[model samples]
Target: MTSPQPAETRTQKRSAQTATLAEIAREAGVSAPTVSKVLNGRADVAPSTRARVEELLRTHGYRRRRAESTRSPLIDLVFHELESAWAMEVIRGVENVARDAGLSVVLSESAGRLTPGRTWADQVAARRPHGVILVLSGLDESQRALLTSRSIPFVVMDPAGDPGADVPSIGATNWQGGLAATRHLVDLGHTRIGAISGPTRMMCSRARVDGYRAALETAGLPVDPGLIVTGDFHHEAGYRQGLELLRRPDRPTAVFAGNDLQALGLYEAARELGLRIPHDLSVVGFDDLPVARWVGPPLTTVRQPLMEMAEAAARLVLDLGREDRSSTATRVELATSLEVRSSTAPPREGRDVAG
Candidate 1:
């Protein structure tokens, strides 16, 4: 009804031929792949090539299609095992972060019996997730190489040392936490401190013991060789260690367990020996999990920032596609707090507090 608009000025008229991306690239003297790479902001393209393609895109008024890009988004979360409640907390952290950033998580658990590393690697390679997050402390060299080799952005939680790869790491400072727990007991004048540690291969076990030693030295107390017991990080190990320590003519007045799970075992050992806590013996633990607070006497222990660490790990892996390495290869050490309860006190019956 209004005057017929000319073809050049008609906004409603259908154009038979929509411009294709390849035609635009041909006009810019570059391949269609270059235009696609630059338009998508993929990291695989070199700086010069990316720049050239971007310049052409701007000149040609090319725009990125958001609908297609946002259609398929997924991430991968890998762990040695997922049985513990604490681990579940970390998982929740990861899920919260990823979901907020418009992503869904695919989970994998490495059985961790012998070739779990290689098997996990093959499985991950087959899936090709946008990014990966690892929660295993015992990750082997080949597995690390595979991740880096594939140019996949990954993050590791609770890495022991070096991490030996380009991935970022997020975890609580296990060593410092142990030191804090032991130092608290040492300050309370419990000189004979016995420990129930985890597996030797685990960095957590080694770091925690190191903290125990550091506290003893700081207090100018001689580390007692007979009092130190190495048990699995289970309650049974704690019970066995407790039995051995209680049998000594000079028994430890306080015990520092590697984890809360082991601390429960130590409590059983005290019951077996007819010793009263903070009366005849004292006990402290690491990883102040939810159960630690509910346990008898409300276990005095060190707490790890499980949620915060998980969030940081998630961010590191999610932001990997960005040009800046701001979030990649980062190492964050969260602080630990010591929760004092009725489990510790100065030795009784004229037992000299080792200083």
Candidate 2:
């Protein structure tokens, strides 16, 4: 006797036919209600049964017809991590749009992962929200496919990595911000300038660092590798790296801290070394957070409109969900500006040159 054919082979035989829920349930050796549970992302289904049903559904190219009435009155906002004032800005922006649309907001964190977990995709499908706004996060192919199969729309805001051309994304002009921050320091006659960069894995961080290099090259200054240090965009990294940079014998007369937090950390390091801001050393920073202005001497930094970017992402995702059409302008980058304050000035006398 021949062994029973594999599910794939049996499914392939009926590939020409439009697969129904009953057919999928039969193929997976489960009841119709079990298949329905899997389709609805109900947690009651067993993992093994759900996996089998999902595979059969994918194999059969099953697509559940979407009805606007079936969707929940909520907008899902996902973040890579929920730490810092940076996250608060994004939350406020998303909330503003959700409130206007008469929809409640559901927030989730990926816990530092750039891509949310598989369980999140299932939960989202079950919830069937109006749309999803992902901040500093992207979706994997499987997650994307799951959402697409369910007709759920998603938009990425300031993606930590390249979110592919087909994925809609909202971002700030990070390169321009970096350029402006460094140029401001250069214009103040600081030649030996150091830079603190955020994680290179993030496109935004890389772009900002590139802009910093461009500003130096354009102004006829050498880009010293030794003067550039990497950080995790946190105050602790800033303080730790700041100490390392400032302790160098040929320390930069001015330094561009990657973000406001790092800049604050750098301030502490400068104080410990008896180097006063804009007096013995000039400092520039990015992401002019609220604390940037409240610091002892206001921080000279680049202002990225985080809330505005978040609002744009939320709006775009809702538009996509309602229109059910791909937008012509899928990628949007908001402008960033330099916020000049008392922290930067002409490098104190001879401090302009490396000593």
Candidate 3:
């Protein structure tokens, strides 16, 4: 017989166009066979290991994958609106994860309705996507029930709460983050602190407000009802809330906002009123989103692990479709941190701290 070609050369050439198991293995710090086990949808791979492989592929952009279909990952990404910088970043994170795994995505809006059927569900069902990823604001029992009844895999990026605790959830640690923001303001020795909050329907809005109130109580100061103003958590809401607070004769010396967007608006509102930051009034905010640092007087706020949380949530939901593993809804909670910067300090010259 003629001399045979080298096995390694042949194997490498055959893999020229697609992401090979060896590539994933090296990225994941595992052997090629282990990569095969995961691609085969085997339960032998641990949850953490599976997450690592998925993350590596996602970040590295290893596409052209044609693994056996474990409920084809045609993902449906339902979002509120992509206009807001914060919302857009979350959607981007979700998309990055879905695309890297060689999956497709559908973007939908669940406006007015409690659930997505008329607005999104029916559309996603028609498309027959492998799974659904919801970035919902608030949902009632009827909406939650409808989603729960679906046999298709689903994950949620709550702008509010986990109405259906049974489904896997990934979101910023709003409560802790809020606390950190409030404490930063308090640390500067500003006690007569007020807060402008996001929509009440949002869990983050409520959690952040609660965190502010708790900080005051811990400092032995009664939470002032008059000092708290509620808003929609948008820039305009921030501007409007800022004006309301600024106009008051007994205005707050320090203010904490539910989000960075709102805080930036508040900053503008203060400037219009001839007030200087950290001098006339101190301000702190939650969600140290990308735009936070770029604004005038860099914001001191709480940072949500937005990208990492999105990836984790996406993987958890996708895993449900894999037949090789025991199908159960999983939950993963990520933490947040306080990022102090140029936007906070003590009261004006004559203003009493206790007031």
Candidate 4:
């Protein structure tokens, strides 16, 4: 007969098999009830103690076996901000998926921060939604840990930053869109082209700018740093930057506005300077928003499938929550195409194509 195993060794084996709330509490130097409160996301728990308990739970790979009845019939849709019409397209997409799934959507904003606050995480844990879909927003390590412990899956859409390799995400082919936009301008005989870019911190924005550079390089055109102006993906920033670019002594005959809104702003600036669309200045924009078509002259733009991307993100998050499904990190980028319209044209007669 084999000798009995040591008590300490036996305890270790039990822990490996199943980490209990009491064991986690003991490791965290807190009471079992306190650990439960943290797990349940009770607001009464102190921030410091809650964080400690959460860390311990994560360290032990603790996963709460939640009952089906415990989850709310809802999907959480979070955003960094809800300031633009661009958000409306995303909302419509998520809403379509959520409606078909028989689940309502809970919308939240991080109020300009890239990551939602701790309070938002706590609220999410308490509500126990089926899954979460974040648009242009990310989560902190602690927030991710909290969601993981509760087995609540999340997917990022058009991530503002590099959402790690382990995070599921959905985005558009921004680089390809940018490259196509610039190439179209070049093909139109506009050699001196300018660009208005979105915020530099955003990966999508950076990729778009990079594509623009690539297009110019391939065309044997000079990449003039002085002509690329940075904007905040807002109409005002576009208007302001457009003015600055147009005021230059050697202004570009064509410009690629990062998105449709900026393109509109650029339109306003051109009007103020007595320039005619496709005549004095040719312009291209991205995100082919509906307003792009209604504007004075239909705006030439890149079509990013915003609605489709949001729908995919929502569906992916729900799939991750299914026990039978694998929750591997998945990144999907939809294709972007250029929609040539009346906004772009050949450079004027006197403009130098080689300049």
Candidate 5:
């Protein structure tokens, strides 16, 4: 009898049983093109058909070829939450690039969480997409490892936290945006400025808040702790914080909101309290979203290049997917500019009283 093969050799032998595209297609009762679509994580595939194909692929122990040959024609776009105008801007940007590259985009949400669930990595590996782009999120160790093992590259867009020094990411100059917003209020002759900040846990939030403080200090204004409040970067939180700030007898003549959503909430609060925009209080918001211009009297806000950042991220991930990937970590931060509009003006004297 032949000597028993080593345990590692036997395991490798078992996993080496790979099936061809035609074989997988025949077994799944689908055309070769359908199998190829499923393998590429194309969004056009039907749920039932994709599931059947994926199951058949797993059963047959199918493995994709190395990146040196060819790559899947799909890109994965994962988001922390899918319910916002912000998300839409990013999606449009990525879609623009993917369309030019003749690649399909696959969208997935992390269910309102900072990171995706455990099975997310496995599902992505099974599909073998060309690349992955995560918005306001990061991958865990195992997820990173899984993608690395399969030679699939990933990029982070506006990461929520420290994405480590090695990971590539795209973001805007949030600090400069915050500084510009606050400085605009100062230039409008507002000595007292209150700020509504996003969650302290997020890097963007902290950067904006820091810039606000820096601008205040630069103008020889005292940075009052009471003038600053943290928010969850939502309309509800903005509304609640706006009520608090506007109710104060020593309220500031102007308020700088961390984002457009919060600024809109502040507008509602000011209306309920019988205050007039620019006449009684001036507000500045960040992100300069489309609604910023459509709001009543329009919003004077900092314009962040969200779509451009997304497009850059999409391009970067695709570049990383090439056979000869760059070892250096690439970090790109787009510039931010202030869009002066009708929402801001010189503060009216004696308008700091409760609104």
Candidate 6:
């Protein structure tokens, strides 16, 4: 008589042949209810019993009915738009985390809109991603509920709006960054500072503007309402608002822009008026995009650590996926630092740059 074959190998082969859940339960020497709990990842099952049942299911190749395999190694990334260098930075960060984990990223945009379309969530649900990382985006109640029900974890990065106190999210220190940017300008001896801000509805934008106010108050300078203008955080808005600010009789000697794109637009406005950087006027911006360094005079701006924030969000979502139930909501705000480049200096004495 031949020696008995290894039990696990024999079971593996049998599973490949076609084994029902009942058969797996019988082989694992557990009741069907216990086996069901293990299959569903229910916490009520004892560790040893769940392990035994899982081993049997793995060996027997049992596929749960009407459910996609939970082992999908794909991560979904949702963005408001992928057209900007800032967006590219975020993508690179997420990709770095995904590559290390032996996973791939699927990119989605909200139809070139800030708010996601209703069907976008449904499509994501259908894909059954292992996890999701949303950049400057949000989910409605139904969408959030759907993902939760399916055990798909997600994290928000630089959420466009308030992501709620209970939602997991990662963001930069926008308020601190704004304060630093304005403070840098003030330290350079420019008291008459103007600011072109991003959309007021976005939390990040509001926080940044608030920081600017805080810095001004700390320095004993009254916040000038006329000097602050709201824009959409684009080159056009920056150029338009920059022109308006520069045209004033008591033009600001230094201007703080919400982002790098807007800063470049300000550069154009200053150039049009024949004003020399750091000599006639100084400028500061947020989000030190690569273009900031390559400009005529490198931009003095706030470095928001976009890539690091994205990486953190991606890692958090994956970790949430592995956990049965995270006890508390997670929120992370990476520090933002000032990058002093060649774009700022003290106001010129005796003569107004705008004239």
| Residue 142, model 3, lDDT | 36
Ranking by TM-score: 4, 2, 5, 6, 3, 1
Q: Backbone clashes in each candidate structure, one number apiece? A: 0, 0, 2, 0, 0, 0
What would the per-residue lDDT of candidate 5 be over residues 219-282, giving only the tens digit for each residue? 9999999989988778777789998998987888899999999999999999999888978889
* Model 2: colliding residue pairs: none
Model 1, CA-based lDDT: 0.70
Q: Per-model C-alpha lDDT, please?
A: 0.70, 0.87, 0.70, 0.90, 0.84, 0.82
Worst 10 residues of 6 by lDDT: 62-71
lDDT score for residue 173 of model 6: 92
Q: What are the root-mean-square deviations of the candidates from the true structure over C-alphas?
A: 14.4, 6.8, 15.9, 7.2, 9.6, 13.3
Q: Which residue pairs does candidate 1 place in steric collision?
A: none
Clashing pairs in 5: none
lDDT of 6 by residue, 37-118 (tens): 6554556878888667756665555555433355567899998887667999998999999999988999999865766775
All candidates: TM-score? 0.74, 0.90, 0.74, 0.91, 0.80, 0.79
TM-score of 2: 0.90
Give the CA lDDT, 0 to 100, for residue 160 in model 6.
80
lDDT leader: 4
Error of 5 at 184 (Å): 0.8
Query: Worst 10-residue stretch by lDDT in candidate 2?
Result: 1-10
Better of 1 and 4 by lDDT: 4
lDDT of 5: 0.84
Model 5 reaches what TM-score against the true structure?
A: 0.80
Q: Is candidate 4 or candidate 6 better by TM-score?
A: 4
Instruction: Summarize candidate 2's per-residue lDDT along 25-88 as a digit string, tens digits.
Output: 8889999888878877899988988888777776666766667898998999999999866999
Off by over 4 Å in 1: 1-72, 160-162, 165-167, 351-355
Among these predictions, the greatest TM-score belongs to: 4
